[model samples]
Target chain A: MATLDIKVLGPGCRNCVTLDKATRAAVAELGLDASIEKVEDYAQIASYNIMSTPGLVIDGTVVSSGRVPSPSEIKDLLLAAQA
Target chain B: MSLVDTLPSSKGKLALVGAGALALWGLAYWVNEWLWDWVMYGVLKLDSANRVVETVHFFVYDFLKIMLLLAGIIFVITFLRSYMSVERTRALLGGKRSGVGNVLAAGLGVITPFCSCSAVPAFIGFVAAGVPVGVTMSFLIASPLVNEIAIGLLLTLFGWQITLLYVVSGLAIAIVAGWVIGKFKPERWVEKFVFETKLHGEAIDPSRGLTIKQRVGIASGEVSTIIRKTWPYLVVGIGLGAIIHGWVPESFFTSVAGKDNLFAVPLVVLLGVPLYSNAAGILPLVESLYGAGLPIGTLLAFMMSVVALSLPELILLKRVLKPQLLGIFVGVTATGIILVGYLFNAIIP
Candidate 1:
């Protein structure tokens, strides 16, 4: 099993918070043992080279940025990574 | 006075006025073009043969075109001011029963002439004036969904079929989605701080007598007010779009939003947040995305997301909606956009 590392990179805005919650929900629904991290530091968020914040980084790859993904969508991403 | 009384006297006056204004507008346009030329070719010296500079020039030209459009829009809106006030809209929308009310509200929302980004004041005023949130939502969703400008550009760039699909589907999404949002009754989520400007100007009935000159003057005012407020956002949105146009690897979009990708529509919707644009600014890239074998649904989803879910608008709306409401708005809108994308894909050959 690949250990999937997921980071929700954003400042503590409401959208950021919403993305974080939905991402966690998505991970839990999939029953994946993936680790979820929130990267709130501006310097850390900037490291992703993403212009828009509130991004979702899966396994060091930016899967989505600038918007929140639904839980089911994230579940699919996690499942794809496992495959 | 009636037209019969004023026709002879007003003809020369109106003609003179029209000529003067057009000349003034032409001069302003020329100066603007010259400034842009200098900035691009001379000051920046970016008009070189380099492809990069060519793309940069494309951005500059596109920016100026949008500015000119906005200027023209401003001039027109200055004339429309007396016609499109918040109070007038509410009375027209008041006493809304469901079926036609929703459709009428949605239709009015489109022709009511607001760019979604710049419609904030009217939005607040609508909410404050006791207009149904559903009605306001209909306007909010529809106003930016389709417009004459977007339609004209799409028709010229894409085709009549695409344009027709865009208009029909855009209206459908605004109506259905707005009705759905209304069912949820989101008023509770609005922040306490949102001011509902109590005045809500008295509604004007078109049946009421007004001279053509008065009507023209009002329309002009409406055009100017809306254009002035919205011009900067349009430029910035188009500027970013041009940059996206100039760069953004084609494979990136094709891979992510390819026709066979089931996740394309939803993924594109999720991607639309944080980016802001109008339909006109995005149709060019959308055309290219289609050429890349990406699904129509995916591109449509992306267009909806970018225009409707931009982060800057959210930041601005956060000044009104609470965290939960904003999230719901984003979530619901994304769902609507994705659904519309699939609908188009399935229904359109």
Candidate 2:
């Protein structure tokens, strides 16, 4: 299995932290080989063209911006990407 | 590195922080009163008859006082903001019924500390977390209108009585307006993308397990950012207020918008809808109007409309909401504000 690349983008606000946790849980539950990186710089976050924070990026594609998805929902997203 | 490594170990350093805050408070008071007196009356030698001079004095004094207040309030609130994250709020409101959710969301809105412009992210987060749209609306409406910064400024300028009344009524409006919207079942009005977008990643709560040093650093950054963004509006609002204070005849406003005028409440609300201003930017104008003998009801209505029914916020909401839902949102909020205005006027006057 190929390792997955995941990025959580925000200024370290509470919602962003929740997104980070949920993502970690989803990855672990699926036993996926993935590396999670957090990007907090405003310029870097803006480069993604996301006006809202707590954004998520997987495999170079923007999947979500401005909301925290639950672990189960995140699991479906990871499975789809794996396929 | 361990978090404890960053902790301040010296008692002297802690005492220095306390002393610094006291010094700043004294300086702020001096700037608010003595500086205005020295510059406007002692140096300028301008009498009340000189409308231009008086207006200039009003502008300078209010500008300084409000800026000082903004810095202090924003710093403290931003520090508190680090404690209350959007995800935390989502967890609180998620999976609740509309009635309970609306109340809880509105209450949380007062403490969460996001401005109207930044509310979208939280709104989206709430929606994705399965929070009802109506509950989310309550949070959005209450966040901007009932924030502590605005309330602190209001208390400084208008006294605690008026401030408390504003807070109670504002929250009531947010709660009722949101509850009514929830009943409308406007879920279809949300953009398809809001529901469809899925994020995949390891979510870490950035505010979790932070040291005091880190929290303070974050708060100071917030103070600078908020002040930079809001200063221009504050200047413009105070400038307009000075003009009104110095030039406009008391009789003029009283005749038009006084308590006797039944149409004043709705009329002011209509006038306020098109203008975009935050509470800090608008309260100075409200003070000048009150000074000019504008009825309390009309002034309150105008302030609410300016903060709560701002056109810029409406345009921002348009991104996520269809026109129909947006229309309902505006209609319901405006009506609630107008009623509050009338009710206050009847009771007080």
Candidate 3:
């Protein structure tokens, strides 16, 4: 199976920190082989076309933006991506 | 049937719990002042004439009231606002012209769930999608200036009339300032890369197809996030209010910022421009000043300027906007706030 490539895009605000922490927790819980990267550059972030911070991208497909989804929600999204 | 089995469903159970929580919140808010009075004076035998007791009483009462207000209002507003998103707002403003577009943009800005951190990307996205610069400006201006937290504080502290005036004036400023900026051919002043940068990948619409449970969950999370972030400021602000209420004379500000002073409005706005704090954090001070005999117009102007024209936001916007446009944005918005302040001072008895 291909490794899951996930990206969390934010400029490191509180919400961004929360999202990053939640994502890591979800990854640890699932024990998935995922490479989670933090993207903070404006140009790189703009490329995602998200108008809000703390965007979640799984395998290059933007899944959520503007809010921190819970660790369980992240687990569900990651599980679905794996399947 | 068991009590759990007799319940309609998970959705029904969630609704029941939500309603029960809201009712409890209402009861607590209703009895908050009385409860504090009982504990401070009735039970502890603290004399009302004593400044220390009075200050402590004021702090406890206001802290509970404001916290309750923040939690309840933030939850409901966040829940309702879950239905709106910047993507949808952009779609609405796409292909819109200046006058009408500015109005719509300002109105939508109040409802849209946006954060200042995303202001640059949102600006790029909105402009890239053909939304006019002026309309986008109106949205940006209105988003932070006329937020739910500000509205909640205003309504609770100053009553609905002042709150209504604040909201109306905020929207007016956003619309007019945006229109004025629009007439200046702002496109050229934008950083060259903004126009050149092409957005990649499909924009995800997070606002779409959200279930009630999901919305509730999101709202609860938002409530916690906002409260957690703003609590320190809230404590400092309320503490200042208590100090002012107990230690300072009622006429302390009258000599400086009284209605008789013509410079008070502009001066307050200028002082407020550089300071950055959320409306919730600033309102306690504003309320204290107002109680100390500062005019409503000056206080409102101060609050608006603090929330609307922060140094950090201007610095962030400097990335996308050349110095010239940023200057104009600040100048025009500050002028509008000044005018509103003076007008309200002269008119509101």
DockQ of each: 0.01, 0.07, 0.58
Model 3 per-residue lDDT tens digits across residues B1-349:
0122233337878889888988999999999969988888899998999999999999989888888988988988899999999999998998899999999999999999998878998998898888888889999999998988789878878899988999999999999999999999999999988887788888888888877777787887777777888888778888988998889887778887889999988999999978888887788778877877788999999999999999988988998999999999999999999999998998888
Error of 1 at B228 (Å): 8.8
RMSD in Å for model 2: 8.5
Worst 10 residues of 3 chain B by lDDT: B1-10
Tens-place lDDT per residue, model 2, A1-83, is 88899999876766688779889988998999999999875445545545457778888776765545545557877888888
Which candidate do you rate higher for lDDT, 1 or 2? 2
TM-score of chain B of 1: 0.66
> Which of the predicted structures, 1 or 3, would earn the higher TM-score when compared with the native?
3
Full candidate order by lDDT, most accurate first: 3, 2, 1
**Candidate 3 runs further than 4 Å off:** B1-9
Q: How well is each residue in B234-334 modelled by candidate 1, as lDDT tens digits?
A: 56655556666667766876676566678877877877776666665565567555655567766777887887778887775675567877777676767
User: Residue B28 in candidate 3 has what lDDT?
Assistant: 95
Q: State the number of backbone clashes in model 2.
A: 14
Native contact fraction, candidates in order: 0.00, 0.04, 0.75
Q: What lDDT score is found at residue B157 in candidate 2? A: 80
